[model samples]
Target: MSGYLADKNICCGCGACENVCPTKAIAMGYDDEGFLYPSLEQTKCVDCRACERVCPVKLDANKGYPDYLKTYAGYSTKKEVMEHCTSGGFATELSQLILQKGGVVFGVRYAKDYIKAEYVCVTQEEDLKALMSSKYVQSEKKDVYQAVKKTLLTNKTVLFIGCPCDVSALKLFLGKEYENLFTCELVCMGVTSYKIAEEYKEYTEKKNKAKLTFINARSKKNGWFVPHLEERFDNGKTKLTTLFGSYYGYGFQVYNRPSCFQCRYCDKNGVADFRVGDFWGIKETDEFWNPNGVSCIFVRTERGLALLKEIEERGFKLFKTDYEKATVNNMSSLHNKAEKYVVLREKFARIYKEEGLVRACKKTESFSVKLKRMLPKGMRAFAKKIYHKLHDKKTR
Candidate 1:
């Protein structure tokens, strides 16, 4: 196996190694944090080294920002589409286009009653709804890469949307680019542990005494900037919490995988043809600013530009904008430095396993975090804006 990874922390858990193993010697095993790592069955190992050869961490060494062909800030004209997507419905719109052309679309979706996220394929327009919106937790690739390979072999069109690391891993595993394949990478901020997500689900279900029927982590019910986590219960009740005041908020602050802190894909030179993310700091005076939502789209490759042109011709609302201005405040795409929450994250994971989720959260919550959570909705919103302004100024 050529020592797939010397240290587990460096693995992005993309499952490329498992997918490329010829003898099925590699299996994905979970750590305490609920992130996957490759494990080799010594008895079945043939020392082929294929797993190491396909590792994205080893292959994506010359990574940097690619010259953007074009940039845009726009949203879908369809209100219903924008309402369900995380950003400006760009992904949903693109997926619909692929489906209409009889192509396959692969993306993350909830499984096992919303406790986990995994990649699923959809070939029908009606099924595209299942792959919409953001999934904050790390998603299990689970043989989807192999499925994509098989579909490509059939000369069928395929669109794969995922975090940058997953896209890189798929590219490395395939060993070459396919003309029929299209990839879109999300501007990621990092993914939280599934263990944390599961704990939160259990706590909420127990507290409410009901099953969670539906969850929208990126709901625009209260507007895009102040997004809320909307949860629907089986008993006809609903719960709405600010995205910044929920467990997801805590994850945003800390508790992502170790590799996320030192992400190699957080640059302009990504592996995907297109990069899409929230236009975080869009100003009220900007032409694309809408209370509904807005997406910052970067066309990085010729294929991406061609797809953008096709979508534009088909009546998608896209406005060309300055690349620097479009990405000025979107730190997720440019920031490569790891956060300083490693120690705190480790402590939280240990405490979470020893105690319960609530206690672990209470133990880790800083005074400022507590204060933010305690503030009223309006005050919290105001505080968040001020915080973002200061952050942008300092980072600039």
Candidate 2:
């Protein structure tokens, strides 16, 4: 353990430091299920502690939450912002606001050649769209953070967005370096291990017989909970596929980072100034086709609230709605709730072994026939809602 990344007392293992390293010396690999951390080849490291400098929990002289922040998830905004936004499109909104103030924002983007996550800058409107949605994979966002640091070090404002662990990684690496970081975190859905995203690319490339042009994880046209894989062939044909049930196995097919499945900071990880995520479990009717591109948002701090207001003030359609509150219990962590996923670790491992990472959802053979019968959209929604409600209640 030559640097801050290995510090048991402070390391959040977001992998930002590994990504930032120029030598390509550090690799992020999982321990058990899928938590992430930097594994270093000591010979390559020059003992910079560069990874430690940006850690949020480490950088904040006061990294703990305030008394008023206990068990709260809803921010001032109520309605989902964009159809494809993983949580609400609030992060983009906030980033845009900061840019309007002549600041820079850092977040993840898919590379033009590969569907993997890469760090990026949001300096203009076009750049903002790229920042939308949860990429749901491990990213090598080296350029993204470096860009933000370069701008902020010159006293420019910056709104950095990522999962809680990502935020922690960034803050830790930045240590005592910059004073103008506007850090925001996604109320994370545990990250699928890095290998999942990487393997999906490999699988799709061979399976589809085409080079993928875009792979949207949260396509509204598809189900938000289901991953929609889009493949563009050499002939220009675009096709979409779904991964509804086998996210874990598919995610682990490549190999996950060690710390993912057994995360520690989920309940009250003070990794970000504000946390955001899909406000799931909200009730709505068919008219609320707010699907396809809207996101539910939570503002977890005063800065977050102010950023939301600024976003709305700039002609973005902002709506207020009601949301359900999340508890330490009952939420399906999926990836980075960062810890407590282990009680069922064996069960998960068993399921994955049985089905692999990218299996399709269990098809309802009877419903398959019914769906092909050209059932009306309203009827389909009603039927699906009933099935989902019953299913959820039973699971509970």
Candidate 3:
């Protein structure tokens, strides 16, 4: 019964173990927090240790960070592509480049219902639109890793884009390096569950009496500095809620998988060829600063550097930038600190199960939060500042 659960709080739910299980013994099941964990079928288990071998958490423990290369702050010159993307449109540009070269590009996209995200391999340039923007929830890898291996074995170029853990798991599952495979990882903040996303959708649907057709979690509609959780309903009504004002956004930090807080991949050294994320905290005076959005790309391997050069040659805009200066305030790349609200998180989970998503959110709001909701827009800001100041002083 060699399970991958080295500890209660260690699984990243990358699905590498499930894909590698030779006898189909490992199944993914959700915990109270709605995050996935591997559940073994003891009767079917052959104890071959395939699951253990492919576990990224187990393999990455002793692995050192890869050598650093160069960093850049840039965006795509294509206006339409830049408009649809969450950041500088580097990912779309890169994916397009791979497709142009007859390579398969694997990326995360919302399922038909817009409630869950899953990895899909795109071979045509038209399908690249599905891979654009950001999906804040944790994605289901399913058997995509196996599919990727098959493509790699066929001697085809493969580009895989995912969170840091997912990329690491794919590398571990392949068990060896393949020159044809190029991996890119996001500088993740953390990931919530599919259940959480589904529940939130259900709540939104019930409130609006309409089906959810589209959601841009990092929408550029209100500009990138303060992105909105923009949702379009089947009834032709659209709702745009600021990230700070949304329950799902607030809960994302507090109710993520336990492994996320103790992440082994949130460092300058990384296992992927390229790391991509929003160039947060950029100043207007900086040369690369764009009011729209900009991406800070970190090239970690020689292969990544060459591919980046090739993309630039194809009319993609890229600018050299300092890695340390770019990422100094970028918590997504450097910090793995979890939200400090264990009891509140547990309470919210219980309330969510007993009541529903909307009620649970309302119940979890602090006194100050509730008060802000009742106040006017101007008063709300002032109230929030005072509350935070008092709370910080009290904590100190």
Candidate 4:
């Protein structure tokens, strides 16, 4: 075990590091404020950098997340772009363009049927739809490295879209000279657990006395869809879950992996030519409220900027607006939250649940719960926020 970046800008919050950690020293830990960050059982660390190699941040640490990381408001006219996207289908549109130009784009796809993540290769237009929308579950696209390596061997360009860690893994696995790999990470707001989905299925199908039909989860009215839910009934009726609905955050929290509380990868570190996600603040422009929502866009390089412009010209939607940062984007805010909560996760893994931790982190359906980042101090603040948010959301 070696040290690695634990902040959100770099950490994809993927649990690879925790499992790969040999000493079992790296138990998932959380700070008091409530956000989870990895605390090292320094004794377990071999300092081999095995954890480092798999780190999305350390792979391109300095360049991985830029200090001047800026935001952009871009869009797509393609109805499908709006329909299928979590935010704007910028990622999908861009990915399709890359594939159309004889390139391969790699990104996480919502296994709607399984409701888990499966990394897929998008080479055809039809494949693009499958990859669109946010899964909310953790991406276990471990095959990404192999798929990318194989795609790159062909000499065609390859665009890999994921959280920072996924990109970092590609760089680490392929060596430093991955010329054809275009990496894109999202402004991750932590991940939830698969337990939420699994539990939902179990409770709905087994206990609810009704056939689980479908989920129109999240509160958004139109635009892109988030973890939309659908529960069907034999009478042909269905029910939906709002973003702040009873089924999402809290339910997810109850089921997320124990490691999530001690997640070392929850942080977002820079690693893509272009970073993209939902542009949350703006209500849908002309389009209906995007449930999956608009993709929040950030360009860290000229290459990213150029791609944005090209995609815009290629007929994606475009708008100009002042961008903002949530706790998700502010590193200082994260550090501030880190203090009191740092070691909580260490204690938690012992109690969070022994066997189900890893399984829960991979699927948010259990709780739509995943790990969020914070320094020890920040964790305390997060607790207050969660208390209030949950209280407020639950009552509403």
Compute each candidate's TM-score over C-alphas: 0.94, 0.70, 0.89, 0.65
Better of 1 and 4 by lDDT: 1
Kindly report which residue stretches of model 3 are placed more than 4 angstroms away from their true locations once superposed.
338-344, 365-396
Model 1 lDDT per residue over 130-217, tens place: 7888988889998989999999999989999999999998998999989999999999988877777787888888889999898878
Q: Give the worst 10-residue stretch by lDDT in candidate 4.
A: 366-375
In Å, residue 71's CA in model 4 sits off its true spot by 2.4
Candidates arranged by TM-score, highest first: 1, 3, 2, 4
Error of 1 at 196 (Å): 1.0
How large an RMSD does model 2 have? Answer: 6.3
Q: Model 3, 183-274: lDDT tens per residue?
A: 88999877887777788888788899999899888877767755567899999999876655676665665566778778888867468889
RMSD of 1: 2.0
Clash totals for all models, in order?
6, 45, 0, 100
Highest TM-score, which number? Answer: 1
Candidate 1 lDDT score relative to the true structure: 0.82
Worst 10 residues of 2 by lDDT: 67-76
Candidate 3, residue 174: the lDDT equals 95
